[model samples]
Target: MIAGGERTLNVVCVKWGDKYPAYYVNRLYSGVTRYLDRPFSFHCFTDNGDDIDPRVRLHDLPVEPFESELQAAMQRKGRKGAWRKISLFRPGLGGMEGQILGFDLDVVITGRLEPLVDAAPDKVAMRHEWRYEWKGQPGGHGSVFVFDPALHRYLYNDFAADPVGSVERNKGSEQYYTSMSAFRRGQLHYLPGSMVCSFKYDAARIPPLNLMMEPRLPLDCRVMCFHGSPKMEEAVEGFEAGLLRSTRPASWLKRHWRV
Candidate 1:
């Protein structure tokens, strides 16, 4: 309970390896403090907690029995592995009950995040993959998600029962597996695209135009996601994403992406 006896909003993020430092967690916590108006608890499920802010709660990453086999399969297929995210669906995660709002470490909070917290607050919600949405493809980006652990444990249960088989059937994609799981049960809800825009796909202009113009924030964007390349740090300094996808320095990021 909060000062006014309101429910505490639990905002979560995952950090598994050395790829992202402790500052990433700090930066996200800082953003939450600035943008979220209500009482909230920020949680980080990570393997390493060194240097993370004390105010931010820390929990160990869930270790599935077949995690090694799952990674081996992903490597064999030459697919990027983000399988650990699925573990968040485990029952009673961190002994946390009720609904949780999660974000990828690579995202930048641009405005009031209350809408995201309120949108489908009781269901499993995420931004539909930007590349697949227009083509009528079914894929969840998994960058942002909201779900109650107690209600969604099946996502982890089924996967754990046959981790390797699940990987192969889903072509080693965790997002697709997660998306399809909720989708099949008619439980998947999509966050509005206007609120959760992608940096590379939505904000950056088309190829030739991108070379000439700086990437602009989409109208009504609340969370700017850097999923594939040109992470927040790289975008801030201007990353040359080859000839077709180059990005000028996004000066605006310095304002919100901080610790």
Candidate 2:
């Protein structure tokens, strides 16, 4: 929906350093292209673009004066997850006119993304993972969120106002700020929990009697988000330990990426 054209959904991911290797991004790109039926463009915003696949549009990470200061703070001991705050609200992001879906690099796509793009046009849509809800109060997980660039400028503006304080107030958590900002604007919509199931909570917690049960494909779920401990690496580990069944790498991914 760039200015005056049909609204094609746009999906984006950000990559920096060696924390997540290029194969992960490439595999995600393959999954989106294979599963999504709607017209869309997949892009990766990254600091290191050399090793990324050519099929994914590589945009340089937006640079600003405060970025260096943020980087220094991120280097301090016990600063894991602090970088998420700065990366999620980077300046000049989502300038494109269509709906933008952002995914964390650690996730593995299991279904179509069109449902997310087709969600309500005005509200910012995100998975309502149970962990974020406090004592029945509503909240959202920002690991997978859809927003329109023209509408959510305040997301970055508020962060820019007090970068350091903003990080501290939200404890450097992107989901907290995203939910708070959306709530303030009265433009937040929660997607069903089944759509973004946590592998650790949903998949791994089934009793031993149900250990052989096949994983059910959620009817309303269009995206499966991997947040926290049961990440791709952990899934691999669980399979190795016989606590989980191994899944073949997505066929589309194998066809495109030999590894």
Candidate 3:
């Protein structure tokens, strides 16, 4: 529990390799510092902490115990699975206990985050994928998630026993697999669509009209995630991929993504 009536919001993110620079974490921390009113702790599970801001706590990346299983799973899918995020379920991360809010490094924190921390205080909360299909299957986008690490340790244990089996059960989607764990315990819930949304699905407007006006922010969306092309960094500097492009001068990205 956090002191002084404020909730202890533990916001975490992960990174490995150099795909994204350290400033992504820095800017995200800066955004959290700017918008969140409650006392919060920021953590980054990363391979290297070199250009990261001093305010953000860093931890070494978690090692996968089932490397052979991981490789087999990836080979079966013909693509890499984001099974690494499964590590978040490991016990006692950063010694936090109340609420664990996970943010992908490529997301832009746009507004107050007290809602994500407060809305479903005792459940595993995350965004629902609007564009995917799986019969009787719930698609949980992995960009943002909230749960207690200690309470969810079984996820890591089960995966340790058979990583490929776990992936196969969820069609190789780590997000869905994670949600299934929460669902099994009757603690699965989706963050309000307005609380966590996507940049590509919600923000990327169809263009010549895009030439005239900027993409309007989603109603009450606190964070917008950039899952694919035109990452936060690319969006900040004005993104253009083939014919699909957000017009030049992406000032909105600079406002939130840059702090």
Candidate 4:
């Protein structure tokens, strides 16, 4: 919906504080450019734009109108920017009027993104949560998601009215609140699991299996999500920690995380 009939696919990612360097944004832009053939804009919503690539459209991180639900959850966990991602729900985010694809800095794009985004064009598009709950209510993952800023404005308005209540009801997960809010309105649909594989379940190897095979990428996966680690860097560096420990090398991750 611009001049000359050109389609705009606004790919957006957010960065705050020092968790991810600005270079991560640049790499994301590079990956997007490699796979997406259409005319598009890659935006970095960040607190500090000093080190980011000039090609990336840097916009200051949008502010929340009130206390965010994620902030309340983070107060006990001692983490910041947990709710910063939700700020993108603001109408016409960064003044870009089009469908938006939100990505976490840690994600690696593996294939063309158009199919999934176009699949549920009239609704919110997202991947399923950490697990596939066949018998229970559905949940969404925030690592990669798509929505229309102008149409899905209710998610922001309702949450702003009662951030605490929203947090408590969704069990303090912004992902849950985000998807459920749209789901109720019949405006949320999930991308196929084969298209958005998780590093932990799909790629990482267990002790006995680490010797059997290396991490395998799904043939149809468009994006690889590194939820709850090892993170993209950890996977690239070949290490795992805590309960999800695995020392097996993730050479494939290192190869894809950048290009």
Candidate 5:
């Protein structure tokens, strides 16, 4: 709430290294602009801002005491782990106030975003790890998250206090640490699965069937997450890493993943 009692949404993303280029951020801004039907400010925290959209508020990647070690750990896993994103959990992130909605650059927005914002307005919310839902595992997927910086400052404080120890205990997974920390305090909720889905698991057909039929976007999904293989680029054209991990060209993905 501001001077006029008007509340604005704060949409944020991070581009720490060269894994994704500037276009990823630019197109993400375009998607949010097209879908979110409310007043909002878009922000990007990155190591390089050379070619990003000018309308996006850019800030240098926030630093932490163990950033160097965190970076090293991420590299060890081929950059699959996003340890630096923990920095965003810090209070006053980019000096902005209010509830924050975050997306990984690899996600493709497909439907209305308001539902996601309204899902868990006060408590910290994230997508339940889809892969482990069947096992009754409790943890969050980092792709999409929403929280108030004021209330969730402890997320960063705890990590900063024991970065290395936390990494070792969580098996170098930031999302694991984040989800369990909030869950233990009874302040964590999972966004509806139909809204945010894994591109590989939910959208694409399983295995051999994928070879014959192109991936189909789930009818009710709002954001499709490309966590591992066949990222937006590879999926748009087509990708075939192997029998188990593969996808045919997704025309719908091509239609939405653009600036």
Candidate 6:
């Protein structure tokens, strides 16, 4: 529990359809509680909240007022329909105030979240998106991000103003819009590469000897992001197979799941 004058932080995750099962959400909630230090609240914004655990607060999906022609263009196979999640950008859906961290259901919490929350307030913090670099610089990935609700109203307004143009220009990438907005506003800050690293890129960087030998947890990494290729199930399998390890190793993740 947080003591007096210590601002409370809220974490949110979105579950749209059957793509992500209840168990995955449950595991994510459990993982966060086990790792995050400061007082926090975990909330799930979902279309269907049935079978969701009692511990996790559930909020209804924002409804679209009317069908617009732009909806047709936003449709894509295997992707969560864009409009369904547009409400999150709306003002006051979750009563979210202060600093908030949003994580996708696919992520795993491996260490304390204070570093992310404690990041400079002037800039919005996120991981680099690309694998390889043009120069010596790293890119920003939007999978995990920390933002101040009071300051980032533009993220929502931009989407609302030109839903079609905004989504199309950004290639329907949410993180891209986030980074671009922050960049335009001069409020973007890149988190250390190790904090929100991709399993695909970093795993390949490990020496061949290290790969063939026993898996050693990354020393500096605070959170290991399983972004594109490997899903959580495969990640769990690889960890068991010694192909993967965390900065904070857990013997039995199942046991530590409950808050």
Q: What is the lDDT of candidate 1?
A: 0.84
- Model 1 ranges with Cα > 4 A deviation: 2-6
**Which TM-score value belongs to model 5?**
0.93
Q: Which structure is stronger by TM-score: 1 or 3?
A: 1
**TM-score of the candidate numbered 4?**
0.90
What number of clashing residue pairs does each candidate have, in the order they appear? 0, 0, 0, 0, 0, 6
lDDT by residue for model 1 (140-244), tens: 888888888778787888998988788887867888888888888888889899999898888777878887787898779989999889899888888886878
Alpha-carbon RMSD of each model: 1.9, 4.0, 2.6, 2.5, 2.0, 4.5
Best-matching candidate per lDDT: 5
* lDDT (C-alpha) at residue 202 in model 5: 90
Q: Is candidate 1 or candidate 4 better by TM-score?
A: 1
Candidate 2 lDDT over 143-257, as tens digits, reads 6788875687777777667666666666556676677778778888886676665555555535452244433435555555566654565454343234443332222222322
Best-to-worst order by lDDT is 5, 1, 4, 3, 6, 2
Candidate 6, residue 239: how far the Cα is off, in Å: 9.7
Residue-level lDDT of model 5, residues 1-259, one tens digit each, is 5558876878999898788999999989999998899889999999999999999999998878778776566666533467768878887878888889999999999999999999988898998997668889899898999998788888888877876667777767778888888998999999999999888889888879888889988998989999988789999888978887777889998778898
Q: TM-score for each prediction? A: 0.93, 0.80, 0.88, 0.90, 0.93, 0.80
Flag regions of model 4 displaced more than 4 Å: 1-3, 67-81, 132-135, 240-244
In order, what lDDT does every prediction score? 0.84, 0.64, 0.77, 0.78, 0.86, 0.65
Candidate 3 residue runs with Cα over 4 Å from true position: 1-7, 133-137, 242-248
List pairs with backbone clashes in candidate 3.
Answer: none
lDDT of 2 at 58: 84
